[model samples]
Structure formats: C-alpha cells, structure tokens
Target: MTATQPAAEAPETAGETFDSLNPATDEVVGTYPVHTREEVEAAVERAREAARWWASLGFDGRAERLRRWKGVLTRRLAQLCTVVRDETGKPVADAQLESVLGIEHIAWAGKHARKVLGKQRRASGLLMANQAATVEYQPLGVVGVIGPWNYPVFTPLGSITYALAAGNAVVFKPSEYTPGVGKWLVEAFEQVVPEAPVLQLITGFGETGAALTKAGVDKIAFTGSTATGKKIMAAAAETLTPVVIEAGGKDPVLVDADADLDAAADATVWGAFSNSGQTCVGVERVYVHERVHDEFVAKVVEKSKDVRGGSDAAAQYGPMTMPSQLAVVRRHITDALARGGKALIGGVDAVGDRFAQPTVLVDVPEDSEAVREETFGPTVTIAKVRDMDEAVDKANATRYGLGSTVFSKRRGVELAQRLRTGMTAINAPLSFTGIASLPFGGVGDSGFGRIHGPEGLREFARSKAIARQRYTAPIALTTFTRKEKTDALVAKLITVLHGKR
Candidate 1:
C-alpha cells in the first residue's frame, strides 16, 4: 500500500519521450513515450468500444480469459520480477513477493466475480411484498486507473484486475518511474485478451494522468499522495465521475504490556525498513505501554542494527525508489534531532543520497513533523504511553488512518478494535493486505473507497436494481376505482402494522 505523485520534472510536449533510470545505479532502465491528451483520449475511446465486447462475455466467459491471463503471469513471474527490480531498485525477492500477491488477486477476482456480482433476489418488505425485487452489479464501461511507482505491480493491479473481472475495460496510466512495468503488464494481458484493447497503457508524468482523469472514462481509480488524490477528485468532479482514491498513511503499531517483546521488535524492524519504509501501511510510529516501553525500544534498536539498505543481494532492503524521497527522509530525521529526540541507532547521516539506513528515534514530540507527517522513509519514532487507552488515543490522533498493527497476548482483537483505522493487524504486520478476501482502503486523509475482495469487484461496477409487480393488492389502494373505504382500510392497516413500532 504505497503510492505518491511523481517527482517534479520538466514538462513534456507531444511526441516527447523520457527514460526511466535505476534509482541505485542511475542507469537507463527503459524509455517510454510521453502520451499526450489526444493519445489518452484515443485510448479511452478504444476502451469504450472494448468494454461492450468485454461485457458481452458473461461471467463464465470473462472468468475463463482472466484465468488464461493469470497463467501467463504465473509462467512469466520471474521475468516480471526482473523488470520490477530494474525500474524500482527493490530486491528481487521483494519484487517476487509483490508480483505473487498481484497474481493471487487476479485469481481471486476471476473466480469470485460471478458469485459476488451476479443477480440475486432481494427481500421485499410487507408493503412491497406484491413486487419481486432483485439487484446485480453491472459493468461501468471504461475505467481509468492512475497507478503509483511503489509496489507498482500489486497496487495498480488492485484496481486493474478487479475492474477487468467486473467486466469493465480499463485505460491504465502507470507512474512515470515504473512505466516499463506497466507496459509489460499491459502487453502480457494482451496475450490473453487480444480481441480488443481491454487494458491499455498510457505513459507520462502528471499531465498524462490529468488527461486520463478527463478522458470520459466511466470511473477513475487513483493511488497516490493525499494531495494528488484531492486533485484527481476535483478533476473528476468536472464530469461527475466516481473515483476510488488509495492514498498515503501514517500507520502505527501498539504494543501491549503482555505482548511478546521479541515478536513485536522483529515486526517493527521489518515493517519499518522493508521496501526502505516506502510502504503506505508500514509502521511509522509506535506507542507502547509504559511498563514495556523501555524494553521494547531496546529490542527494536538491537534488531534493526543489521537492517541496511543497498543494491546488493545481501542488503536487507534496497535504495529509495524515488530519488526525491531521500530529502524527505533526511528532513524528518533532522527535525526529530533538532526537537531533542534521541536516536537509538542510525541518525541524520543514515539518510544517504539513494539508500536510507534504518533509524530509530525515541522521545520524539507527538506534534513534531517526524511523528505527525507521513515520512515515507525507513524511520520510526517510539513513544511511551501510560496505558493501552493512551496508546490507542495517540495512534488514532493522525489524520491519515490507513493501517495499523497491535501486539498483545490477550487483548489483541480488543485493542485492535479501538484504533480508528481502515485495517489493523493483530500479532502480525500487514496481514490484511495479504488476504485476497479482505477489503483494503482507508478513511479521511488516507483517501476513500476500497480495492480487493467483493467490495473491490463491486467498486468497478454499478448496481442495477429491479422491481416487478407480482400481483394486484386485495385492498385495491393503487386503483382509481378504489372506494373511500379503501383509504380508511389502509390507514387502519398502517396503524396496526407500523404505528405501534
């Protein structure tokens, strides 16, 4: 769950192209065309036509094609991982993990689309018992998807795969930094869906994304910073297009007094530093019970010592995928130090040009930028609270409520229910994202709407409700020939049936 707007760069004109570079080595990974508005509109038009044909294939027909696409992705998983590592500078294993999750989503969406979206009878109340009611989710024509660079495959596919399974054609504009990965995915999809341009790709920076939002697509699914998400929503409002925005987060981890200190420390280390702390739902702040705060901090510091970032296989994590993000990490560390926070491990110097070493800070002020803002780096702040109540209060104080973790031997679920977040993991880190059946999203500044599971399949569809008259009412209340006594009878019936309640 990581997404952000592209870094500042020179504007592009029509027919222009840009190169994606390896973040760690600064080598050209791939060059892609900067799709202009005209191009984007053309793609949307194509998708509009494709959507008809795609939807013509009923659930079984679409599911069969989706399975074929899934097989292609499975067979070429290694190749896709290489492209992911090359563009994003993540370790191969990390890329593989992301790709596997994406594949799992494709499989789940295809298999469950019928059961989740098929037409079904709906209950008719006593007043409407004479009518037969039913509802079904129908495709919403062409969908526009603006993806993020971090977790490029998984994050975008969260929308793309589900949209396809829901019977809507898609026009995907992947982040400029990871356009190659997007292109690879689109081409692979073409292998199985060659009859039409069901899933098209457009590449560029913000301009291209803006065009996509205005391309007359039925809906837009955007994954990025809250600021960018706001911009997307504003643009979509011009056409009254519905949107699903999966944005940033300032996730927290709460440790109870009876928690397993070792397990909590290990989860913190991995949750904070993995992917160089670029995860949207990753652990950014920790609130531990006063009884175990000191011990937990010490264990986190000891465990994070070996977690270093580099481009090598031996490195625990990779370099910052976006070079501009390094300055943000450095600023957060500097602010924490300037505010009298103590670094138990790496300090300001840990944030190098590309790779940011894991840094653990204690005694950081809750009002400070490091604790309040979304650092999106490999850094975390540990603060002690008087009890679980205080911990929950502090954890829910942030404006961004995306994901969180709770470590407790006895009150795991009890405490997890108290945090005001979209999802929470008990005794684990990011467990919700791994489950294909769970809905993933957030509220407030973390953005709105969800992707994944039945909700995700419905996200790309429009509900169609139907009601048919089954029989004439014995009271004859709706007929013009009804007598005045009929009204009196209905009034008496209403008094007897609902007046009491």
Candidate 2:
C-alpha cells in the first residue's frame, strides 16, 4: 500500500513475536518480531525520510550504491542459498539458481535505470511547434513490498530492485516462512548503503502484512495468491494507493502438431515439476495435439520416472515449502482420479506429509478442480486436442493468463502471441523468467502490473511531462489578447487539416 498523508507516531515495542519454521523438518529456523500497526507506522515514517535522501543522490549515485550491494549478494551467494534451503525446503541448487536470477535483475535495474527513467525530448504537436516538450519519471518516495516464499529472492527483487533503481526507499515485508532470507538481504544492503535506512524489513504473518497496508507507503508491490491480492487491493483502496500484483497462475502449455515431441515432453516435465511445482508460472495443464499426443505422454512419463522429491542432495527436488498445501494437492489429485483421470506417473498416494512426487494425469475433464483451480503443487493434467486451434482455445479458457509456453518448431512465435498471458516461452520451458530485458507480470485473474525491464522501472515512478515555449508564435492563440481574426484562422486551419479525416 502507498501513503497519501503523514504517518502517525509509533509505539515503543511490538506486542509479540513469532518463529520461522522449516517445512521439511518442522524445526525453528529463526524468530522475529511481530510488528504491530504502530511499529509499521514508524518504519514507514523513517522510510519516508530516507526516501528523500536517496532521491537526492540522483541516478548515478544510486546506481553506484546498488552495484555495490549487488556485489555483496554475489560474493555471499552460497551463504544466502543455505538460508533459503533451510527455510523453504528447496534444494540448494534451486535456491542458488533463484538467487542468481535475482542478481541479474539487480544488474539490469542498476545499468538501465538512468536511460529508461531519465528525462527525454519529445516532439510537440504541429499546433504547438514553437514549444519544446520533455518527459521524465520521478520516484514515488516510499514503496512497500509484500514478498512470496516461493523463489523468495528472485520474485521479490523483481520489484525491489526496480523500485530502488527508480530512486525510492523500500519497506519489505517478507512472508513468515522466509524471514531469514529477507533479513539477510536487508543486512547486506545496509552494509553497502549505511548512510540511511533505505531498505527496511518487517517480518510476521497476515497481521504484519495488514499493518503494512495501513502504514502509508507510496506504493505496494505484492506477489502471492489471487485471493490475497484482492485483499491487498481492497485495503489499498481506503487510501487510494496504487498496487502491482503478481499473483498465482494455472498456466498452460500448447504443443502444436509441428512441435518436436521429445523436446516438448522434456520441457513439459521440467516446467511442471521444477521446485516441486510450487512456481506461480509453473505449468499446471498441458494441451497436446492429437497427432503427437500419445508420443508426448510416453516421453513425459519416461522423463519423470527418476524425478523424486526429498530434502537431500540426490533428490531432484525438495519437499513442499508450505505444509498446508499438501491437503490441497491431495484433494485435487483425488478429485481428478475419481473423475475418470488416469495417472501416468504418481497418484494420490504420492502426496506425503512433507513432500509430494510429480503427478501427471491424462483423460481429466477440463472442468475438473485440478484443471480449473490452482493446485500449487507438483501436479499437472494433459488433454488431447484435435488441432492447434483447439489447443489454444482450451488453454485460453482458464481465468489465469500469467505465463504460458508453446512448443512448435515453426509456429512457436505465432502460437505464443495468441496466448493471453503476460509472458510466454517458445519451444522452451520458463525461459522468459531468466531474461533481464523482458518484463514479467500477468493479466486477468493472475493479477496485473509488471516488474522487469523498462516497464518495471516505470512501475515505481510517476511520469512528469513538461512543455515550454522556445519562441513567440506568429499567431498567439493562447493569449487573452489574441484577435478574432487569429481565432478564425486557427479554426480554418483545424478544418483544413482534420475535417476530412
């Protein structure tokens, strides 16, 4: 949430505290303060002051500081990965991959902010040819970031890095499941920019997040479930604060008849099961052309045979980071199997207390719970389509349009363009996420607003346009002293130029 008025004074201390637990072991990872609304108000007030000093540094100064902070993250990458693994139960390699992607966003935001948000000349219309026009993006002062636990580093930094680069101080509220990672990031940032509290951390459960919305920041960048996004929006409306929501997605993949069967199978398996299929953009439903449907299914099942989920080095993935999600996953799987779906890999039995194996279903109805709602687990459903046209129609039928993939040797780009998603990958799985130059977001129920590339830099900024007269016009239409003849001439000019069109 963004602030519109001065913040209230804060209390001396928060009322209570909470602990972060490891999902796999159910052990305490760390304990953090449960900040109250008053405490949240204090953080925002301090951030408001810090934003002023940060904005004064200008683009070059801010970029230099951000690069130094990036260096800290790069040098201590392994240590950070360990923290992520412990809290989220993800494999260390997966944690490192996400962190590395976050580092890329930092580099991109630092290197490109000046060029993207700096003032630039613009062409004045023919009617105002005597005036010079220019536009520049200014920071929104203080930004509030509510981060998600999955890919905690990469997803949140997509917003945090851009907000910082656009010259605003950020107040981050990491999910209760991943507070240590957030603390580590904020601490690293402080080491590089110790002059002020440019980045602040608030940790706790739903109450803390609710406090943040009422704390009166300039804008809020949230990444989580669609239900939570709606709540954030409703809270932000009280102050008319702007928000950017990157919510959950029941993404789909389209396999055209021309697609490479082996490649499509490998991509689908990896995209659907990676990170134990907890990824917001991970593939939940796959649409295969009838010609290669049997081949693709066989290949996917073969590839998924060795993929296991456990908290160990040898395991391909790790346990479910959120324990409660196991029931939801189980319910979806049970419903699918009961509704005439056949499991190609794991089934309802695969879902355990801590982890769930990759479950692939075929012959599932399009209206089943597994297909229509977000399972948010290591599960996917495959459906055969008569042609590419049918495949696309089935893919677009869902309410979510966050991310999608198209596997076609020839029609990759064409098919990708037709999907109503924020980002798409052609002939590959989740490739758009690694590219720093592309913007990442979603549409419809998946939530809206972007947080990468030029669009991201502008998300935390307010555009200001300026026009100034360079010289006096021969005919002064704007002046009060303009003659009736001049007005008649202006009307005649408009008629000659625009009347026919």
State which candidate has the highest TM-score: 2
Number of clashing pairs, model 1? Answer: 0
lDDT of 2 by residue, 357-428 (tens): 999999999999999999999998999999988888989998898999999988888888999999999988
What range of 10 consecutive residues in model 1 has the weakest lDDT sum? 1-10
| RMSD per model, one decimal | 4.9, 3.3
Candidate number with greatest lDDT = 1
**What TM-score does prediction 2 earn?**
0.97
Query: Taking the tens digit of each residue's C-alpha lDDT, what string does model 1 give over 1-501?
Result: 011212111123457999999999999998888988888888888788788888988899899989999899999999999999999999999999999999999999999999999999999887678889999999999999999999999999999999999999999999999999998998898888777788888899999999999989999999999999999999999999999999999999999999999999999999999999999999999999999999999899999988899998899888898889999999999999999999998989999989999999999999998999999999999999999999999999989999999999999999999888989999988999999999999988999899999999999999999999899767666669989998888789889998995
Pairs clashing in candidate 1?
none
Error of 1 at 484 (Å): 2.8
RMSD of 2: 3.3
Question: Model 1 lDDT vs. the true structure?
Answer: 0.92
Q: How many backbone collisions does model 2 have?
A: 3
lDDT of 1 at 127: 69
